[model samples]
Target: MTSHPAAEAFGATLTPGTRPTVLAVDLMRAYFDPASPLNLPDDGCLHSAARVLEAARAHDVPVVHTRVSYGPGGLDGGVFFRKVPALAQLVGDSPMGELMPEVAPRGDEVVVVKQYASAFFGTTLATTLHARGIDTVVVVGVSTSGCIRATVVDAIQHGFVPLVVEDAVGDRAPEPHWANLHDLRTKYAEVVDEPTAITYLEGTS
Candidate 1:
């Protein structure tokens, strides 16, 4: 709702549906570990996402998580792998591809392995959500300008309402983080904080 030109021009906002699901996108070691080349700025985003996960579990909401991985030599990944050399470290048997313990998926949760930014790109995410009767997707995870943004867009395109938890999504730089959040809030999804998302998940909103 800022006075930005784009926000004023389009001003589209997606409202969350009653049957909501939690989607933790790409909360993996490579983005959380400091030693990894893909490490993000800090762990604040992870902590916020963990809180949302706790709320989701408490409410017995369908929780889905995504991790990016590739087969040996990244043959499964075409141009994407070649464009980002750092992605080579995530292929086959690499610890970097594993989801971080902070926001790990539970036994009954769905874990979608994808090579691209959108969870719905080459996966059965949309179909699975449809089968589960899920209408709203409460999203949290790393790199807001990347997978988070892509997932939000795809979620809306696939006919699911996307609600992005602002504090739970981070980026390599603050500028892109803030910028993408603004754009997402203005158009694609409903950008919210962790508390707002949890309230909605609990059906109190």
Candidate 2:
């Protein structure tokens, strides 16, 4: 059998302590809003992501959710906030900024609110995962060309193996999605479909 490069690189030596955790990032209202310039309605990754979430739950893998929200008046948001001025409205109680119901935060599960593309940048996500004994991350969510890609890169940088679920992530446009996924598959993380990922997680679990 032909070995997948990423599976050869990282999947071969997974240990019992290195439990896989699922991170559903930025599947929020702002991404789906028609008025938002960053909207990616045609990217039907959310439904696939929901399926991943269900599978993760069934397999007992820890689930974490992330949303990009600025603090009051976007005080915590720096230069990046200025570039996307509209993102400032996501702070506090803005309805347009909340995580969509289908992938909403559940009781006791970790929810990370980030201000930048990398979920681990200036966030408690890394610490939380480390404390939970999570060494591998199954990353799913919106805008494959943006935050999802950034998080996958950072996850690898932090010494955690990141597995990108192919159909479980979306982007505003097709070109960037294809380009980023290509780059990720070669460099940052292993890119696999939901079924393969579920099987891998199950085997490792």
Q: 64-158, model 1: which lDDT tens digit per residue? A: 99998899999999999999998998898689988989888899999999999899999999999999999999999978999999999999999
Clashing pairs in 1: none
The regions of model 1 sitting more than 4 angstroms off are 1-8
TM-score against truth, every candidate: 0.94, 0.88
Tens-digit per-residue lDDT, 42-65, candidate 2 = 747888888888888877888999
Clash totals in order = 0, 0
lDDT of 2: 0.83
